[model samples]
Target: MANKSVFATMAGKLLPRTDTRNHEGAQAYSLSPRQALAQLAATGTFNATFYAGAREQLTEVLELAWQVEPEFLAKTAVFAFERGYMKDMPALLLAVLSCLHGDEFGRAFPRIVRNGRMLRNFVQVMRSGATGRKSLGTRPKRFVQAWLEQASDVEIMRAAVGNEPSLADVIKMVHPKPTSAARAALYGYLIGKPHDVLALPELVKAFEAFKRDPSLPVPAVPFQMLTALPLTREHWVAIAETAGWQMLRQNLNSFARNGVFEVEGFAERLARRLRNPDEIRRARVFPYQLMVAFTTADAAVPKVVKEALQDAMDVALANVPAIDGRIVVCPDVSGSMSSPVTGHRQSATSKVRCIDVAALVAAAFLRANRTARVLPFEQAVVEIDLNPRDAVMTNAARLAAIGGGGTNCSAPLERLAQEQAKVDLVVFVSDNQSWVDATAHAHQGTATMQAWNKVKLSNPQAKLVCIDIQPTTTTQAKGQADILNVGGFSDQVFEVIATMARAETGADHWVEQIEAITV
Candidate 1:
């Protein structure tokens, strides 16, 4: 017989070496520069996470931006905004692009900075000198000028709500040559400069008129523009009637506090609208966002409204694809996962935590694939039964309320191997900072890779995916033909996971998707 202990299999020798340490100081493999950029673009909010601060994230992103091709950076900005539904990182990437003279930056600018908040973020980042330039420069100035010239009156009006390098500030710095008298007046109005009031656009005129006379019908403006006025029940009712899906969802408590729900039939009507399938689809609503609204709603909010958010979650999770084979999803419920999903900002920290997103992913998988198993893990596999028939939000809440010990990324996989479990796909949703499993004797590769190697012995065709919910440059499992390391909390991730599980892709599937992006 061959010396089985002394002579390892070819696969054993082929296991990639651990090259770096995770935030927890665990053995991990560093991602390639391009891979790191994509991951950061999808997950970095420039806010402080449990491990990295806002400044550190900003510095790392800039470092990676300099390492990749300018074209990749441009495509990434578009991808982050359009698919990932991210705000800050996309704007930052666009700001970085603006410093270069290439057409990629110019092409990506209009697409990424599509609205007021984005425009403000772009200008703020540029002026802060974070992207190697403090000024918009000649070409970027042209883009800014074009944006001001081309935007419609209403579009520009809606853009007037946010500040801190406000649209007004951007206008002053860029000095956009307004193409029409209305636009010129609008610019002056935004910047508080004297202008002919008669030249104001109809929407602006309507807003001004409504401001002057409370009895006048409420103008269809941003919710922020209406808050200062002494609004009556009728005004609040009118605001609810015209508010968009997102605005209504976020301000449910505010509406309740202002007695909008007290109006007979208004609460029921708003509830119906909240759960409307068309509106849910049209809003591109994330299931977790609905979860946030459901969780954060105050006691004053109506019962029907909360239930409607639950229904909206069902409609929002339509993107969770059904996989064809046995699946096991392990959601990390460890201590570090308690940090906010978008990280911690002083006043703007997200209520949704990394654990909530992980649980949501696992619950979504179980809902889509009824037979799929869920193993919520912390220091080890914390066994918990989840019903597929239950609502995604319910199952997610149950899983999210589990253990908060050290992270052991290999625990669930180790359990599967121990039981000789057969799985076609194994998904691990985590922060990818597993320190409990990094033993002194196991220096060749991560404990996750070791456990995965064992699982692969029995099921050679199985695939593994690590869905990272935080911005980090390392992973427990290195990318390979059967392993995928992707990040993001958006439903866009579901499509890639489904494609990979169906064997429609090879290694670098995530990178391939980003590379295939057109400018």
Candidate 2:
């Protein structure tokens, strides 16, 4: 495991190299937009350089979408846009709009443009396209029609058209006649006119017909239209019943506000969905969701709802593979990590911080590995006891107790070496901004490298995994053979670990293993 160049290989493939330039015979690579977004999302700090770099990268990615993997490009663009951290909305908007009109935009645009503000941008960008040199193409037209069919807001659609005489021709060319009641409503809504009252029965009938076909996509159109209907409690119940439990879980707040929680059998239905393994895995329920539920759920809600959330967390983590040997989970609870995970504005109201994310990652490992030890670190380290059965949020709270100091990345390895602890793996969950003790000259290299080498003497097969939560200008610790660098929290980390455990050779093979599970 210690004989491969995993970090360099993975970094080369995943990190953008466009930033690299010849600097006096040496290559200097600035952080890519993807990396910048990761840093911003992790630390929630305002960095002008990273912001400008990210804006440039976004434009580059959008223009080159035809040359890149659509899924990867879409994920990068959508994640950055949705994080709402960037101060420059217009640049982000243009980048998002370009991606939407790019090849294979269908895979992501629908999911991203659902936000009202983003949808407005879609209209504005389309208007710009109509008047500008670029023509308003079929793809954008199709997206607008589809979005209108799902969510028919007369004002928004009119705003999209905006008396652009050229747009009327495009709308007519794309949608000449209404094929269904939803389309009829959309056409009527867009033209600033109302459809016949008789269309209501047909819409309901169409919705009911679609509800019976499991092969069909979820009835997003009918669900959205329901908000405007003057329906009885039974009608709302029927709509909820038709949408199924998965949709209901994602919109718990809406259901609660609509008094759907008071509906009989609602709690039982939710509980059953939470316990379903397939649903849990598909939803990818994480600690963030649990924290949100804890912070946002009303006091009047039933206890069963809380229990269901806990059950969902358990089901989500049920499949994590346990480590085979002694493992140490080191979570960096430094002041830097206490910054909000998204943006400064969000920090004022958000309970999630980078430290919380690190703690959650540590808790995940502790829950999976029976013999694992957890050390929360900043300038120093403190041992904390944890039970596998403890809830993830509980573990995070305990880990968050140790905070407010500079990050000394070498402390954990140095401490383990001094104590003669025979550890097989050391997982450090941090942003990797380790400058506190990094300047010290040591036998191997940096302080972290020297300490890691000393620990390796006692445990030659020990592997180091740095779960980098942010982007850094500093280079990471190098290893002879057994070191891995991963960003963010996902199942991808475990896949890399499993590959290394099999003693996989060659950087290409490792890259393939990681990329296979990327999406």
Candidate 3:
């Protein structure tokens, strides 16, 4: 009851708009808008308490974010949109554009509007505002035009005459002048809708220009148009040669859905692309991409295809810095972590759970540092043998096997203390739902804090790093000079670790330093 009350109290604090100041119950300073958005996107579940605070001060946060760190805000919005967190999306988008002055919105708008999912949501959100007698501010107009220019015919047609007549009026309000071959192709499609005379000529010119310069970037409009047109095998081959691995990866699902290969020898070519070590090293693949691939790969994908993907991931993993300290990773495998990750769409029978993220983080540390040990815990601690060369998912499965009956967050530290182990860093990957038995130590402090104090006493130099994989409640380990609390699964998490390892002042100092670097 106390634990539940603690969570309720934390949520209660966030309900008030004026109480934005950082406090023990509400660590507002630590919860940046970007970080909060990341947590929401990853978990697919919004904490009403947390989000209520965000919604109340949404414009203020956007204003501050734009003034201090526009790039972070822009990037976070794109990521949040892609991750399907859309509750405050209409306001969030408007706020982002309002805060950015001059051509800032113009430059950032393209990236946000290019996604089909984003475009669909934009139309819906904008239509809802129109229906509710809310104003569609002038700032989103530029983005709407940009989206119209780049959108496929299917999307344009859907927006133009589909259910919402206001959307058609909005689309007709802004006319995009096509400057690029791709945009020209999209323009041609738009004009051709009503049998405009310039349509054929525009399409021909765009195709000819693209055929002459295969190296030029193909925007979505032209790509979709070309797919519909009768293009020769040679043209598709040229497009394939010019398209980068990132593009190929992005379109893989589309290809699977359409049962069409944009390029010949799709599987073999992608496999070869993944095998290139330099390409893998240079690719901007994030940890979440790997997670998605592991979970969503079709059963028909060949063994070699899966192996190639794994090889690419391995190359990326090589970049993780090897820290110079003995690190013990304690991943909480309690029943709480069995819940499905927030936004991941999986079947009812799927076994993939939130704890997989904890395992992956532990594996990442193990792979990065030879001195790292994995101590998975539920009600108690258990050691799992891990090798740097082991596949990450394999390590996750191994860790998940030692499932715990209850959450005892302090068990890892207690085990280390019992063994008199001198660890430099103790990383707890958990939901931070640490609760003592109702009958035991009800009036005392948390078992995690008490165990952490004992560990600190034994090894004064040891620091506790709590990685909140499923942060649903207030963390048991308070943010302090020696304690670092990070949420979500990102490569940035490792960057923080590397920075902490090198810093002489301790966790808080480097935490500030990292925040500066990000900002």
TM-score of each: 0.96, 0.65, 0.66
The superposed Cα distance between candidate 3 and the true structure at residue 250, in angstroms, equals: 6.9
Candidate 1 segments whose C-alpha is farther than 4 A from its true place: 1-13, 441-443
Q: Native-vs-model 3 lDDT?
A: 0.56
Output the number of the lDDT-best candidate.
1
Off by over 4 Å in 3: 1-134, 146-188, 191-197, 200-268, 277-283, 291-300, 342-352, 387-389, 401-404, 436-445, 470-473, 504-519
True lDDT of residue 432, candidate 1? 93
User: Per-residue lDDT for 1-519 in model 3, tens only?
Assistant: 557744443211122121122212322223444444444333333222211233333334433444445555555555444433333442345345544565545554555555444554555545554223344456666667767766655465444332333344554555566656554544555444443334434435455566567555443332544565545545555555555665554555544444434344776776788667776545566554665565576765555556777777676566567877788889888876775544223233324456777877788778778678889998787756777677776776687666657777788987887887888888888766654321132233445655677777668877887876643324565556677766556565676666665654443432233234321
How big is the RMSD of model 2?
9.4
Worst 10 residues of 3 by lDDT: 11-20
lDDT against the true structure, each candidate: 0.88, 0.56, 0.56
lDDT, model 1, position 367 = 93
Window of ten residues with lowest summed lDDT in model 1: 5-14
